[model samples]
Target chain A: MKIEKTEHFLNFCCEMGRHLVQSGAEIYRVEDSITRLMHAYGYTDIEVFAIPSCIILNIMHEDHNYTKSIRIRSSAIALDKLDKLNNLCRRVCRETPDIDTCFAQLREITSAPLYSELVSYLAHGFVAVFFTLFWGGTALDAVIAFASGLAVKFANTTLGRMNTNIFFTNVCSSMLMASVPLALQYLGLNIHIDMIIIGAIMLLVPGIAITNVMRDMIAGDFLTAMSKLTEVLIISLALAIGIALPMGAARMFLGVM
Target chain B: MLRFLPCLYAFIACASFCYIFQVRKPRFIFLCSLNGAISWLVYLLTDFLPVEAARYFLATIAVSALAEILARALKAPATIFLVIGIIPLVPGGGLYYTMDYLISGDFAMFTAKGLQTAAAAGAIAAGASMVTSLVRMLTWRKQAHAQS
Candidate 1:
């Protein structure tokens, strides 16, 4: 391959890997996918290193070495988008499509529309209600939880659109999760305020992040494991602070004691 | 009917998470939710067990093993299912009570609840890590066999 063509091919390779990492693919998976793509494209020697935040790779082509580094902003888990990218990687390994065609396919996977906001809101509400029931809450508690879910969902979506930092977003959503039911309880409702808040708070609990940290550690990616561990701790701290702020205010202002 | 509510709620919770995660394939959502429901059922069924934390460990092991199998069969990441499926087993109630006790300044109750919460979380992590490590061992053996 010409030097120019090799550089372009390296660019394509890094782009795909970058998307995978940015979209929350595991570190090992990102490295595996990139190496597979390069090997499928007939590059005999390739080395890839990917973390949650970035990807760096080197490939040998026609006695020349081409290296590329891609920096990507971390994103939330989107299984559909991740699946699409994985499928594209599989296709490249099998079909060996041209660079232009591969680029077009990658673009399609990344740009595909996510589930609608309404769907997300409804899902959040359902999660809150069902979790309320599962935790032995009464119907009234479920109702309160459902409303809290909607409030948290609204906060997350609008705040996300405004490009607020994720810590702020987590804190805001958790505040709503904590305060909505408490506020309603203050309005003379006979509900298990604690149950409702627990259910709503479960939606914000970083389950995926916790699980990923374990998987990363088990896979021997200690750096990624530690980074994700920090993320989980920070999210939990944010939840604690978010909930504590409102409850403390209520205790003083309304004399809820 | 009351006894079945937990499983029903588990299904709804998992299915809703499927939507929240933007799972594109309808079939995947069903299978993944079923995984969640099954794990919850396991948890409920073993309630009669003497050790409370052991039940959570058993439930999480079931979830992780099933997730590994399904991920292989469907060609998707196991985390998609495992994360959502384990929600029912998480120590949310314990966490809530821990916070409540702390807020009320009941240090004894707070300490008890906090320890219980930690035990539950630890049980879950132990179960999941065990299964995942087992899966890794199996794969490594297979690779070594192929190479040999």
Candidate 2:
């Protein structure tokens, strides 16, 4: 009886984590790991948002029936649906997300509460920093700029399913950063294009597809990973061109030469 | 500090820019702030660090893993944190500079620098993926063993 209960819980955790990703949770990889832990617990029906991050799973050793190793393995990413609703209210004062309604919807979709959005932010920051030193400072500037823009595109596409205004996001940011060299010259901040490396470190923020591909690959879902990665490459290419187009145009028009 | 303002603001702008994509509800402002801080911190560290070449790889791993952990703890998705945090670290400008170099027919230096930057990026991914994938693979293998 205990084993069955445990199995059910494990399955539930993995399922919810999976759903979170499918529903476009930003932190799919984190969910992937949490679900894996859930699978180990033998809890086939693990509900994340319903409970807290810590869930106890007991391992039954056959040699001694009474003496079972009570392992308290914990899973993270507890959304606390109520908190999300409140947070939603604070953030969007005009239109609050109805907690009761959101919970009902969750029953159909099977996801965590909403706290995991914090984790997604960490992932974005990490990637942004990592890309900063790829080239000298000059090259780094442009890349950072693009990653910042791309982060939005990926975020919108994954979670909100909104258009994200990919085109202008890049144009505006790049246009701002493009003038780094010349603009600084006027203010006695005569820095080289290399100085912009820190500026461009955010350009190729590969959040959506990277997380998706990694999760799919880990789950033994090779097809999804491949497709997701291909999509990443395409998005990446588009992102590359976005900045390039504006920079190219500005130079020609301004006669930077 | 003032010199870094443009990059900083650009990073913030792009980091918050995701609200337009994810929910369009403005409910994600906190989410946006969190992402912005993480990504900005990483980018800023990379920018200020004295060790230019080798440290980039380490910084990438540090940032990515942090995002993963933060995601796990926050009950949100890793994408939220990672996406925002990654804003400050992309190398879009490098490709531009390299292309500009080529466009100007300064093939030798520009091409070489471009390749170097790409390689640096590869190094970052390779390091992070190695650890994350290995742990994941091992965790998976152990589970498969248990099931079988």
Candidate 3:
């Protein structure tokens, strides 16, 4: 029964993901997060997933990505949100005793903080360039690091739209990052360029902006994504300065190796 | 054998990834590798081009035009070729030098290399952009003439 529910939820999430992508929403972490939520609740069957899963999902998917100001709704409604989850779980469970499964499940649902996700892509790129030059890591590490960064950035930008209750993507990205130094070391490569490349690629989602700018220019959103991209470019320039200036200062003060 | 292959492969991968995002053409792969190899050669040259300024941006234009033509012929991404080719030119080392100097408190080396790198990147980007637009203009003119 549990297996059946899990299967249904997975199917639902996949369809929902495709639909979101089609509707032009950047639904990155939604699927993974939703699946983790289902796994937590121990609801592994289709009939059990019917209304409640859809309700939670529908609410989560309502807004994202065009950069509209987020509505600052009341925190008092958070319980109402949790109640929706509890009520849905109960309805789906349909008289299955041992509320232990439900409560235990709640504890397992995970989620990520936003600021980290926002910085991931740029970090990846910076590290990529860094590692290749100084530490002497090779191509494989660069690719893996950048891919992980992309996934993380996508998650960060889209996570809010995909139910904040689940946080799997953030953890996945962190784990990927933690593995970078180890990967570089395993190959017996110089650690400087090797690690920094992976780290830099963690943040290099440049192609996204490049493509978005072209599209916006062609599509005529002129003021929005382009202006936004300009703002992003300034921030990136700032971040680069932050990294470069401090190092530059130190070099002038100290002697080179 | 496999040592240089990593650099080559990384360039290819980066180019290919950009292509997937439709930033440029896939034939850009050959152009970038070809350009990178040339830049590598030029870096080895030291006589005609100064390692200081001319090396990074000059090699970039040669590769950009080459990749642009390859892109036109193959009907693929232009940026792909430029990006892949320029991979070899990325001042990964300069970045570290600046970082290391900063960490060790060596301001002089930091300032010197930092300005050089920022200038190199700017020069490369500027040159590549100009070459790409020029290529487009030439291509369009030829097409227009042919139509008549």
Best by TM-score: 1
- Tens digits of per-residue lDDT, candidate 1, A36-88, equal 88888788888888888878889877788888887777587788888888888
All models, DockQ values? 0.70, 0.15, 0.04
- Score chain A of model 1 by TM-score against the reference chain A: 0.94
Model 3, range A1-257, lDDT digits (tens) per residue? 35444334444444433322222221122233344444554544311111111212322222321111111121111111222233334343454434445434443421211224334355435334433432355555555555544544565446546654222433333334434443444456444433543344324323233333433333344553455367445544433443444334333553211
The lDDT of each candidate is 0.83, 0.46, 0.43
Which residue ranges in model 3 land beyond 4 Å of their true spot? A1-190, A193-257, B1-48, B99-105, B143-148
Docking class of 3: incorrect
Model number with the top DockQ: 1
Model 1 clash pairs? none
Q: Using Cα atoms with residue i matched to residue i, what is each candidate's TM-score against the true structure?
A: 0.94, 0.48, 0.44
lDDT of 2 by residue, A1-257 (tens): 34554444344334434444343442434344444444443334433221122222232333222111122222222223323432332332233233344335446433433434554554444333333333334443434434443454354335334434444444444444445444444445434443443334344345435544654565555654675577566655554555455445545675443
Clashes of 2: 94
Instruction: Give the residue spans of candidate 2 off by over 4 A.
Output: A1-103, A107-221, A240-254, B1-53, B134-148
Error of 3 at B82 (Å): 2.5
Candidate 1: stretches off by over 4 Å = A1-3
User: B1-148 in candidate 1: lDDT tens per residue?
Assistant: 6797789888888899888887879888888888889888998899889877899899999999999999999888777778778888877778777777777789999998888877877788878888988998999899999979
